[model samples]
Target: MTDKPLGRSAVYTVLTTGYTTSTGPGVAATVSYVSDRDRHVIVDPGMVAHRDRILGPLAELGLGPDDITDVVLSHHHPDNTMNVGLFPEAWVHDHKAEYRNDQWTDRDAEGHQLTESLRLIRTPGHSPEDITLLAGTADGVVAFAGDLWWRPDGPAEDPVAPDRDDLRTSRLRVVAAADVIVPGHGGAFPAGEGVPL
Candidate 1:
């Protein structure tokens, strides 16, 4: 599958760069905000040191919780889904279904287009249900890869992945497709070269 350039590009903002401790219990999920036409999406609104870490940046963008139209989870880990309740009005998207209020619409995330320039693709590895959000922005395609990489350095390997082979294959696919990668628990980085294969 290829990502074709779109006439109207999406805009993305890194709301918070998250972190994880190697030996201790501290962890946070990198959160991102994406906008395309009428859609306002929050990607991985997970654990953070403080709620302001999320809300403040959103406010700076002239948006409030209520303005969010959708929320996407890469997978169902607590670290990647802790603060979803903050967006009470947005539809929640995951690998298997879309949830909004009482409705749970079952649909495959593979090639699921959220907007003209925003879509989801299954990249299961870090978790069996892992999916990546690919946004066609002015800067090129940006992949919000949930724990497909914990960071740009790759961590070289994922200790908790259910399937390492699938993870590697997905990594290659993403590196080939994306110009930039916003990892699950770290800041964004350019794809290729240093990326772990």
Candidate 2:
């Protein structure tokens, strides 16, 4: 519903229809955009249901579908990857462990540099293929955490993650590596400042 700036990139949280509560929607997804010197990169295109909402923000930023050079999936969840088809020309990257599709290539274990300042880290936790995109900007290290942590007010634990241990480990790694964290479902927050355990 709101787009916030995280370093050089912008974080857009899209509310999807699923379980709704008085507090908020039970499920929400995050889509982020990082502008490199040459082209723009989209992280987690979000669900098909929220395609228009996603594209509108991009348009406001003067970036069309064709301007996006890459689409990175943090994981293979429907909410995270459903809109991938919208960008046919962009290179899609995912963990080879989960997606074996020939069209999707594997992200390096060490990490892949999408731009001079943006890097992709394989931080599997919420899913076997979960990854966190780290970008060095004027602000600091901004981490786009895909389901690594759910809500900003909630605990670091992700209720949906099958492996709690893995989630915990990944959460710590993200916190240690990032100054600002763009969570999968909420607004971006400072790392290790007011985050719950």
> In terms of TM-score, which candidate is strongest?
1
What lDDT score goes with residue 2 in model 1? 80
Best by lDDT: 1
Tens-digit lDDT track for model 1 on 1-197? 48533534899999999998441289999999999989999999999999999999999999999999999999999899999999999999999999999999999999889887998889988999999999999878999998999987877779888889999989988888889999999999999698986
Model 1 weakest lDDT span, ten residues long: 1-10
- Can you write out model 2's per-residue Cα lDDT over 80-138, one digit (the tens) per residue? 77787777668777764222225544446346666657777778778887888787777
Which 10 successive residues of model 2 have the least lDDT summed? 14-23
Alpha-carbon runs more than 4 Å astray in model 1: 3-8
Q: Count the backbone clashes (under 3 Å) in each candidate.
A: 0, 0
lDDT of 2 at 171: 78
Assess candidate 2 and give its lDDT: 0.66
Query: Once model 2 is optimally superposed onto the true structure by TM-score, how far is the C-alpha of residue 62 displaced, in angstroms?
Result: 1.0
